[model samples]
Target chain A: MTETPTSSHFKENAHAALHDAPLQKALQHVRVNFIDKRAKAVARLPEFEALRDSARDIKDHTLANLDLYIEAYEARVVAAGGHVHYAMTAKDGVDIVLKLCHERGAKAVTKGKSMIAEEMGLNAALEAAGIDPIETDLGEYIIQLRGEAPSHIIAPAVHLNKEQVEADFRRVHRDLPSDRDLSQPVQLLTEARGILRDKFLSADIGVTGANFLIAETGTSIIVTNEGNGDLTQILPKVHIVLASLEKIVPTLEDASQLLRVLARSATGQDMSVYTTLSTGPRRPGDPDGPEEYHVILIDNGRSSMLGGDFEDMLRCIRCGACMNHCPIYHAVGGHAYGSVYPGPMGAVLTPSLIGVEEGGQLPNASTFCGRCEAVCPVRIPLPNMMRHWREREFERHLSPKAMRYGIGFWAFFAKRPTLYRLSTNVAMRALHWLGRAKGRFASLPFAGGWTRYRDLPAPQGATFQSQWRAKSGSVH
Target chain B: MSAREEILANIRRSLGVTGAEAPRRMAVDDRLAQARSGIIPQRGQGDQAARVATFKDEAERAQASVVEVETAADAPGEIARFLRDSNLPATLRMGDDPRLAAMPWSATALDTAHGASDGHDLNAVSAAFAAIAESGTLALVSGPDNPTTLNFLPDNHFVVVAASDIVGDYESVWRKLRGGYGKGAMPRTVNFITGPSRSADIEQTLLLGAHGPRRLHIVIVKGA
Candidate 1:
């Protein structure tokens, strides 16, 4: 969360994450579970493709009129007695939240999980302003305590194991019996509950991430497994809901439709444990809700995506289904993508948000596997989007010189098919003689990574084009 | 000069939409009805329950205990014993429920209380506002008997459920909330707790109680 791994320069971070054993294990678990669960969920729906198309069309239509929907959402929230704040950038979002926290003289804040907040680096800003932000979501709290960015979108700490948590608790709670048997799962929960309970009641400000913003009702929906979002929204005197501007849905009905795909795609569940709809602050005569509510709508480079070819990117619900189902994502994991958002979505979103200068390499991280597009509920053509990012990156001179040259060579060769076929046949015969071991090759030129993992089958003696030509009697 | 304009202008510039805006494609009124009517086709009777059982089985496999009882009265003693066995304090926080209120708790001496109150007391007893059987979730709504804070603040939290309150699906619960609630009414807080507070942040190690109740005790009592 702290570092932008997608930036062209963060190769060091990517390399580190790629090799980190525990990180690798965690990534494997997320990749496998998400892929399997999403496959099963998609299989259950007879109209999966049609539903995806509908969701995509709805999102596209809404985004095309994003400005209108945002205005309407703001009006509704204001009418519902909530104040709306627009943030043009991450800095603006942080500044607004900091100002609100300062106005309330807040020293501590209880937080609900919001990836956008993490994207904007909100916690550091609050801490710098002297407000201790308490992450109330169990996963968020764990990552916060560990002082790390979330590895996955929905399950922030999906990469972690149980024993490591025991060590962290022991380190933080020194007074507790160090020997407290925590190998059992319940014991760990008991320890965390004991600590976070005090923070929930005592924190002066509550911060949450909004899943969807319904323009019609001026309501925000937050879906979670733990009940922290409810406490984060209701317990504090001041509640600040942070969300990306693209999250706006025209109506509660649209919000529900999105939520339907959301839980099923993310966790293979009919619905999350908690699907809460909060409309502004508590009304008059309401006793137990926040006295003041603030909705900070963050653009942070999103609106630029509205009408362009990449406009469909706004339709993403952050369901992470595409990333979950991507084979390349499974093998490489999120950290390899090098951004706050990662995996296939990150490959497209990171470059889109940060521009090609920093995030260009992200798009090239994909294999153009259409699995992401197939699994995406909103049916965003993620591979195509990544390709666009690649094209943009190339146009802006962000792609590496070597890759650019390689692409140029391929393009040139593709145009001269007869020469390309002749050249490739000769090259393939030479490489086969040099590399073949029985039927497979143990090593190949310019493909060390692939060869490192598994054996690469040797090339056939004749080229496919040549075989086709012979069959068609066109060789003469 | 104004906050709204400044914010909007800044966003427009950064997004590079300062000069021209995209043509509007759809309006809000066009999408209202479908958004609010979040209906999923109702599965045949008992299919939802079967799915819920699978979820419960998954939770059980992960080591949390699951039990079903007829009423709320039997909850206090079971939770007390569980806490005792776990060596946690006798003080517990209980959710507020009518069935729980119906139970005669004069027999037990531990702290009996309900809403955002100080939970320094170890053993607090309350009732679940609703039990969502679909996810094996216990809904805790903020009220006089069931304080929202009690569900989160206590180290050892006990949830009492009546088998009858169990609904088959989340959609059913939504329908109940939507169709039944009067206009302009919302609970102060509605908590749907599936498992105890858990995190797997440290080296991917799953930590059970990093922020909320470490132990979740569910008491299913006989007909209240």
Candidate 2:
């Protein structure tokens, strides 16, 4: 995790990503793989849609009574022989973790993939504190080697091909033979598995993120396709779960409702290979499990999201279906978004977490395709929240001067019907006559943004209003 | 104020609620106590035979090999034959589960080791607490009976699930947990495993056996 977010320069980053040959080639895998798998998985279960509605209701109930749930959840954790630490900010969360690591005299820590850690820059903070943080997830390990952020939430190395990973392994694992046949993906996987196994055994502290925290059972659950998260939590003497306070559900049954849709929407599996529920430290007679359990509940601006316009965004399970189906995300890839999260969900969430001024460029990244809403298991209305962000940006004058001026100009004509019709009528005929030769605008004044990428069709002699009026009687 | 109090205060403020509201507290208490289940898929419903069939089909679809045995005593020989056929090692590690301990391991020539693994073992087996047919998931709880380490550390994993323990959905397994472990008290770990470990991290080309068990073999015991 890094402290800097290049979200303000999203336009420039996108510009660079559009032309990056290797990145464009890598993004093809995402466009082809995730969407089809999720579709097939959803089609198999008739209860999938009903389960989604149930999941949404469960989250909405929990959020409304969040304070009480947190109280109950804390009581359970404390009773189950685990410690609960509350962090009001990401910095506080990092300090809490660092303190815990220092208390244990930890040198090496094996970490499962956690977006909360990515948001808080936990790895960099750990490294700065002279602790080695080893990423256990194959995708996470690959990205960590390249010193890059994850392009997709679930598929962190989706922006990389097998060749990039092969090179990274060869560069870092210098002790291995140079002529090793790392041609296939499986060979690369096997190589990383062998390397990480030793680290898993040696690491003193294991860190992971929880998909859900059940208040009734006092359990923190992780749903992973790979069993890395389980190994990370189970092996070490100290297991630390880094989670947001909003992840709590009231009961195991409620978690079941959410779990039903989680894997299908994310990886298109009936169930992920491993869905582990870790309650607390090991029992008295238990042989091989963590000796201590700790949960760092980080708020980092999510509490204020309650009862607000962006409250629905809190319902997201981070399944990554939104990005998989996004047209803009397909074109530019995740690095271009310049945030830990990418795609439509990121567009709404980044602004909330990082402030509208820095992350305002992201909300405008959507084409309003609405596939994200349709496919969302909990049914978060992403496009509407992006619209809310746009309004906030416009009101605060955080949007570009040209966009503001253009919107203002349109608003002026929009308010007065007579003037609007008159201007549109005159402008339409002029454009019709001027562009009659080519019949399209390859380049135009004040429309460079649109025409630069693709041509805008010229007006067909008359405006839509005039054409509508002429066809009104006959059509009726 | 302490961090916990401050965070709680912030949440209550945003939610426009007093922390001690009676109705809200009641609602939360009722929800937790009731622990009502939501939608459950109908595919895995019916008698034990139907559930076992659905479980096998779904498990195989997830790339886990499943075999049926008439009794718990028959599991070891079947697993040994599977190991011999697959060209795997004759040795395997496991935890000290009583059901597995009751099995006649000496009947077969397969060398069996007990206790938790330290990552050197190639293959291991554990008796599952329950199995869900909806997604072909085996629910294994953690303790000395069947240590959680045996589930993840080894390259190859064999889980012996009871046919009677196979339920139609995840909710059924939750009820069984409540019945067995008591309300609000559960094992340190309950792992629901569906297939062998796999990763699509490298260019979305899925390759099994990333970090956990490379091969997951399930043996369903029909009856006592």
Q: Per candidate, chain B TM-score?
A: 0.71, 0.98
- Give candidate 1's total backbone clashes: 42
Per-residue error for A474 in candidate 2, Å, reads 4.9
lDDT agreement with native, every candidate: 0.69, 0.93
Candidate 1: which stretches are off by over 4 Å? Answer: A4-6, A10-13, A37-58, A160-189, A283-287, A425-461, A474-476, B1-27, B33-39, B44-111, B121-146, B154-224
For model 2, the superposed segments whose C-alpha errors exceed 4 Å read A473-476
Native contacts conserved, per model: 0.27, 0.93
DockQ of 2: 0.91
Give model 1's docking category: acceptable
Q: A3-80 in candidate 2: lDDT tens per residue?
A: 589999999999899999999999998898999999999999998889899999999999999999999999999888
CAPRI quality level assigned to candidate 2 from its DockQ score: high
Q: Which candidate is the best by DockQ?
A: 2
Instruction: State in Å the error of residue A413, model 2.
Output: 1.4
- Against the true two-chain complex, what DockQ does each candidate achieve? 0.24, 0.91
